[model samples]
Target: MDFSGKKVLITGASRGIGKATAMAFAEKGAQVGLNYRNNIDEAKRTLKEMPGKGHQLFQKDIGKTENCKELIQEFIETYGRLDILVNNAGIFQHHKIDEIDFEEWTQTWETTFRTNLYAAAHLSYWASQKMMKSGGGRIVNVSSRGAFRGEPNAPAYGASKAALNAMSQSLAKKLAPHNIFVGVVAPGFTETEMGANALTPEERERLLAETSFKRMAKPEEVAHAILFLASEGAEYCSGAIIDVNGASYLRS
Candidate 1:
């Protein structure tokens, strides 16, 4: 129930679920390391609101492969260790197949995959190395329910998330020997900027109507799930995909 003295890193921590997760960890006594891109002011503002020690910001875009390593490096340099890594940096673009340009499509794929998966992959590798040095650690990859339900026009985004599901499982097996746990949180429609702006009122209504709760979930709800998975309470959880969708994506 406590994360006292734990060093944790949260990517895309400048806003949304990432920011919420950071606060959750900080309040629980974990030292939070935040990663942001081109939003120094907001990142700092958010950091000021967090509740614990070691709250620092590392400006790195996961869209660029190299930044992933740099983020881990800066985290270690700042905190001397990494106890948990939350892969939350990702993007989504809506482009139908016929409307998708060759260049734009490539960029979309790279943007979504590199930031969503590869960055996580590199950081997982880097984090695992650090974890091994300290006996073990925890990794939580932020995925989406769209990975299972499919995005209307964000195919690359869906693929990237689905890939994280597989990747986390693989890494869990690899890192289990070292006591490091790897898992994913596949959130359904949540009240993040992307979620709120992704559809019009009518569209959002339809989306909400599909859920048992008939409303979008708060980011803190999903953050709570992430916190639990990283908790000592969830010590045996590895390669688990915890869904926080309010029954929107339940299998028939």
Candidate 2:
């Protein structure tokens, strides 16, 4: 899909799937705004690696509600218009019920939900408003297979993504009449820094074995799904959730 003249904003673009998605959009001739909380170095590297120009970077902690609004505003100020918004920023933490104290448990849940769900919700709210006036736009949320298969060790992460999926569908219906589309891309374990850091060698091997491909997903594979959902002629798939797990998990 040629995104020439389109403007796209992607969160968590410093690395992994976010970085891949940002580069993909840029390569397709879209002006990209790369957002990252920390790791300015990596973010700069990603911006430099993009094939096209007009790719900018915004460093904001989206875990906060206000930051989400500010991020979208800053992006619009820089790019003039937002054609797509990819809510790819998320946090995954293990807070087992039996293993953590009440205070810690609550904190973990708050952080995870704020970063994973609330940020996306707030960003979408503002982005949709802009899209409404600009004629139309697309929003693609990066979810996880754990939302379906479960994350026993990271229940909050799993719960947050499930909520994200629900919220995306809800917005899909609400925004469709305005010509704005919302879709979701749920990927299994991907070969990213965060994914690798979350697993032990043994656990990694076991998880890979579960997939039909016997390997973890590459960040670009998930990016491809995100782009497809955001591409032209994909408005019909607004509320759909495309799985990129290589058959690791399935649900009817």
Candidate 3:
């Protein structure tokens, strides 16, 4: 797990799991490039809290296709090489088929996919290209348990994450020859600002009851899985999906 001299780029790193992962990598001696959108204050706080030097922030809306390219370019220019890329930026919007209007439904699907799936695909392509030239690299994607079970309220969110999982596996197979490894971490409801904001007291209670631990996963817990997958000895684990859901949901 010693990432000394490694360079990593993480998206949605202003807070929650992304922030935790960035800090973990920093502590392990990796120079980090943190990406956040529309949250300069939180991003700055995360940057200041990092334990090491040579870390920088890139404020870009990764939901936009162009920004993904720009962000990777900026990180490469700043860090000289890329060792790991964590595609954690995502959106979860309620777009129940029976509840929302056609326009809103379409828009939600578009926005959700753009942010959750497309951005990750584009970044992986660009990052893996760099990794190919540099000998090897890792890409750890953040998915969701919703991808396996279901998201009655946010179908688009579930679909995007499921698609992300598929894409990661495809890349894992295609990129392995080039020394680029791909893995996924699918977490259930976690204790994060985003997750908290999306649930009511009753809803939170119900979700917690679904887990064996009777509680949500912590951001740091999810980050630990990401780090393990990104670590050097885990090259053989490429294309694997590790669940950090506290046994909230399971699939055969």
Estimate, for each residue in 122-239, the C-alpha lDDT of model 2 and write its tens digit.
9999999899999999999999999998999999999999999999999999999999999999999999999999998999999989987989999999999999999999999999
The segments of candidate 3 whose C-alpha lies over 4 angstroms from its true place after superposition are none
Inter-residue clash pairs, candidate 3: none
Ranking by lDDT: 2, 3, 1
Residue pairs that clash (backbone atoms under 3 angstroms), model 1: none
Candidate 1, residue 28: how far the Cα is off, in Å: 0.3
How many pairs collide in each candidate, listed in order?
A: 0, 0, 0
Give each model's whole-structure lDDT.
0.89, 0.94, 0.94
lDDT of 3 by residue, 45-133 (tens): 99999998999999999988899888989999998999999999998888889987999999999999999999999999889888999
TM-score of each: 0.96, 0.99, 0.99
If both were scored by TM-score, which would come out higher, candidate 1 or candidate 2? 2
Which segments of model 1 are wrong by more than 4 Å? Answer: none
What clash pairs does model 2 have? none
